[model samples]
Target: MKPPPGGLTAYEAAGARYERQPYNRSGRSGLKLPAVSLGLWHNFGDDRPVATSRAILRKAFDLGVTHFDLANNYGVPYGSAEANFGTIFQQDFLRYRDELIVSTKAGYDMWPGPYGEWGSRKYVLASLEQSLKRMRLDYVDIFYSHRPDPDTPLEETMGALDHAVRSGKALYAGVSNYSPEQTAQAARIMRELGTPLLIHQPSYSMVNRHIEGGLLDTLEQEGMGCIVYSPLQQGLLTDRYLKGVPDDSRAATSRFLSEEQVNRELAGGLNKIAEQRGQSLAQMALSWALRDPRVTSVLIGASSTAQLEANVAMVDGPPFTDDELAAIDELTGPASSANR
Candidate 1:
């Protein structure tokens, strides 16, 4: 069979140093994560086509993006993304497992009934086991609670996280969508158990700035790292919609980021700033999130190989100038409105 377009054959001719992109320490841990990590969040779900999903993952890892982030409920049917990844991992990359950083999460709705979700011990530990079964892996590099379960006690969640790390099922533990207060609380609990809470994942972008409102400061104070999600604001921070949304674009078809909202209002100064840096709006948005040293990586989703290639290229560009920063700040105000 012919090699997949924009797939493994893109650089089959040369030896790879695998040092094109820089890596950062994941919190205070000895392991380092690449600046950009691929997320099996949206497009890896069952409803989407699978070949492109395979290509995106393969190309991403080939480009030195060793980290792959996943969660238990990542498919249209929930759990299908993990299953899909299992097939890919066993078929194409099992031998190189040591070279990869695999992560999965629980704490959201994975099953049904009372034991199905949240941060309870019964739920969190069971969910991680289910995830490992689906991914066909013995252990994940990191495991996280998908969200802060207000109903479940923080100690229960922290206990599950520490247990996962201690039992050799997960090497590290993290939390997502957590507030500064919750993070602080989790840290105290995890530190007492000797886990050291590796990182926090949050939805952050030039257009979505919720993490900036003290979350960054809190992370800095506590010495935790952050891996930001949706750095592109779905597809709003890309050239795909600058001239108006393309018919086949994510904005036009995606349920996560809507089309009407793009027509309503977007950070207007993005085009000018992106043009100044010779990058697409998406590239600029990724850079904006990574500009903060506290961020360990930007978790991005791409539906196709071309889009992934374009998004990854942003790392090679030059730094933003003072005037460029001022222009961007002036353009995208602090509304935190979704482009959708």
Candidate 2:
């Protein structure tokens, strides 16, 4: 609102730093997004300092990271993520809204009671209305059903998605945490409703490889793009754990990525592979996920601007060599939640 402090457009120096990165196509869609997108899943709640969050958001856009991801349940307290984004949107990014692709989802637990979470049309619609109010926007570029709700009817969920696009509330629809089979079904239904399913947001990294098991194939065939979250495997794939958890890492602050999850054995294996590649494990993890052409973008989270700068630079890092791939295979091996 106040000219975005230093202006939303990057200064000459910032533009120079961003000159080398290229945008990638999101499936067969006309959309061209940066290879790296930011996820506001954490540190965007009421508890975290807002100034730091706003700075990160401003820096992200200035450097060409246009797509920002969020969900109803992302905050330390529910609905805070959207509210936080809303604040930044009004404060700094309002004028540059056309240069942004803002997406928020509503399939996870956001409030108490039976109607609060899941894929029900009633719940989805209500959640979206609240999100719109919080985000201070008439529409979101992409809206996702956070996950499949087995108890709810698929038609009802798909119907809500269709209505969102048709009613001019959401430009595109996506499904997160859905199996390959489920994604196909939704795509089929959306086609009939005249709103093509646009993307699939899945948890994928070198450590989390569930999408490799036919999910990638389905998306390719359906003309839906894929954006993988936790591209650093909850920070395990990063060098942060190589020397054991630091007090500042996610392992210390959140239960989502526990220290026990990054046990010594796992960290050792990752460190060896990272060293061989001459890259930080975090950079290597991002490069690994981006290696797949089906992955239109990797959804990354950073607590600070410096961390984001290091994370996105993975785009400029080396591509995997045969020996590096072989070593990674021997270490991380096949994708299994139990193994690493």
Candidate 3:
């Protein structure tokens, strides 16, 4: 089959890229991230079509999303997302790389050995080297330790992040799935090493408000930015499964979001409120997540360009009212039983 015409030329980013969404500064750093960032946790794997992934990425960039979040173990086959992105990136977005904020992470089970994962300097550095090679990049804009290593000393983990920046493998350092206390310790260590903690990636959503307990306050106190993942609660907060879980939905196919977790009663109630506000549940959910000033960006996953566009439209919706906010909490309070 013949390929689309002006294949590459068709991708000039929208002229109003900067005007599309408000960009917030990442903590005290000079870098500013878009209101919504694209997360490649799903849909970019080798299991999906490369053309689909490429199209979604192009649409996201065209809509002014500058940050692309990934991890070493993102794909089902592990590293396939980065490898696939590397191919499309080299072919299409290589020239526009300077305008992008590409981020990747480590500190998870990537390879099968003790040295293959965790916070030790050797593992952290080696993981990044492998990530760089897979992504075909000189250096990632923001590199993160995907999670805290309980056994690995905090100093060693923070030092590894420090080394990543000092060695020019990553322009910034971030930590994910860390608690308030752990974040405070990491910040202290990074400060001592002359590298401020750049950002914290945590799971936050209307249904999952675990970060609100104290982590948000800690990040603000530490002057670190926050880019939350799973803001959609793995598609639960959306209208996708309000009626019932479809066979093709992630809930049915993925282990992360199970069929039993789809609370239809909660969805029906939230959907009415969304309709009253003249918005979709997904749009309202995105807007709600971004309401906090501490959130630098809400990292979202999209399986198609349409979903990406719909998510970006979230910025245009009206802010929630006190009543609306209360209603959301009321509905989510029961459904928030899921582990963060």
Candidate 4:
């Protein structure tokens, strides 16, 4: 494999990397994850250069980020992200496999079949098999049922996750995008099955505060940790869009974020708060999401190593005070009151 743009021929992890960040336990479980985990939901597909993906992975691990999150349909062509990560793993990360907390989910549509999606036993188990093959790993540290299946019985879905751990296909089980009620039910079933749910992955940000309603309390009551994704609200919480959306920004290209949803005024107000706190908007957003101890980590995606470095630096920022929190809530409006 070719080296990344910097022209380095070999890879050696940083010696002081562990000292650079803190690792928090996942709920009451013994597993510990980096305060900031890297997600490969974007920029790891064949649409982007492989060298760039390799570079980001290297930079993340070097910065003491041991977790890499993914899903089956993450790439443009579907399954491309895992396939690409598998190739890079062979080249660089294979040796550090034991030191990594690799995770992937499978509750969304991936292939053209009745069993290709949802939370059925067949689909969930089969997707794990396909994911294992794509990532070239004997087992992932955590296997999640990406979303709850309304049509399928919750018992059957949770049963599949239990089987994944029993079969040695995954070390821990998790669920993402599950509501508080759904999470409690899933945790109950998983606990009954003897493979307790380890964590919950949700979309959370200064603007997207839905999870704050009851999910955090639910996780705490159930003794499960929370790992939030899209903590930057798809880049809206950052200074990138305070001026205007860039041509290459996700707001410009992806349907998930749009120019109409940019909210420059809201971002501007939040940026002021971030500046007062002596941090960038992106860093402040991350630190804010992690303010609650119930939150185990904030999962982030980066287009470049520099972006990754800047984000991981949030761990070093000072904690939010009551006045700062109130100011943030005031800027975010009523949705932020749900948690309080």
Most accurate candidate by TM-score: 4
What digit string (tens of lDDT, one per residue) describes model 4 on residues 1-340?
5553434466778888798889999999999999999999999998998888999999999999999999999987899999999988877888789999999999999989798899999999999999999999999999999999999999999999999999999999999999999999999999889999999999888887887789999999999999999999889889899889899889999977778888899889989988998999999999999988999999999999999999999988998999999998888863553221
TM-score of 4: 0.96
Compared to the true structure, candidate 3 yields what TM-score?
0.95
Q: In candidate 1, what are the lDDT values of residues 1-340, reduced to their tens digit?
A: 3344324443231146286778998666787999999999888877877677777787898778889999999977799999988877776678788989999999889888999998999999999999999999999999998899988899999999999999999999999989889999999999999998989999988878878788888888777889998888776777667678778877777677676767324545687778878987788889888988989999998888888888888889789888887777777665354441
lDDT tens per residue, model 2, 210-288? 7888899999999999998888878877777778889988888877878777766766787777777777778888888
> Comparing candidate 1 with candidate 3, which one achieves the higher lDDT?
3
Pairwise lDDT winner, candidates 3 and 4 = 4
Best by lDDT: 4
Reference-based lDDT, each prediction: 0.84, 0.84, 0.89, 0.91
Model 2 C-alpha lDDT versus the unseen true structure: 0.84
Residue runs of model 3 more than 4 Å from their true location after superposition: 1-10, 334-339
In candidate 4, stretches whose alpha carbon ends up further than 4 angstroms from where it belongs are 1-8, 334-340
Root-mean-square deviation of each candidate, in angstroms? 3.0, 2.6, 2.4, 2.2
TM-score of each: 0.92, 0.93, 0.95, 0.96
2 against 4, candidate with superior lDDT: 4
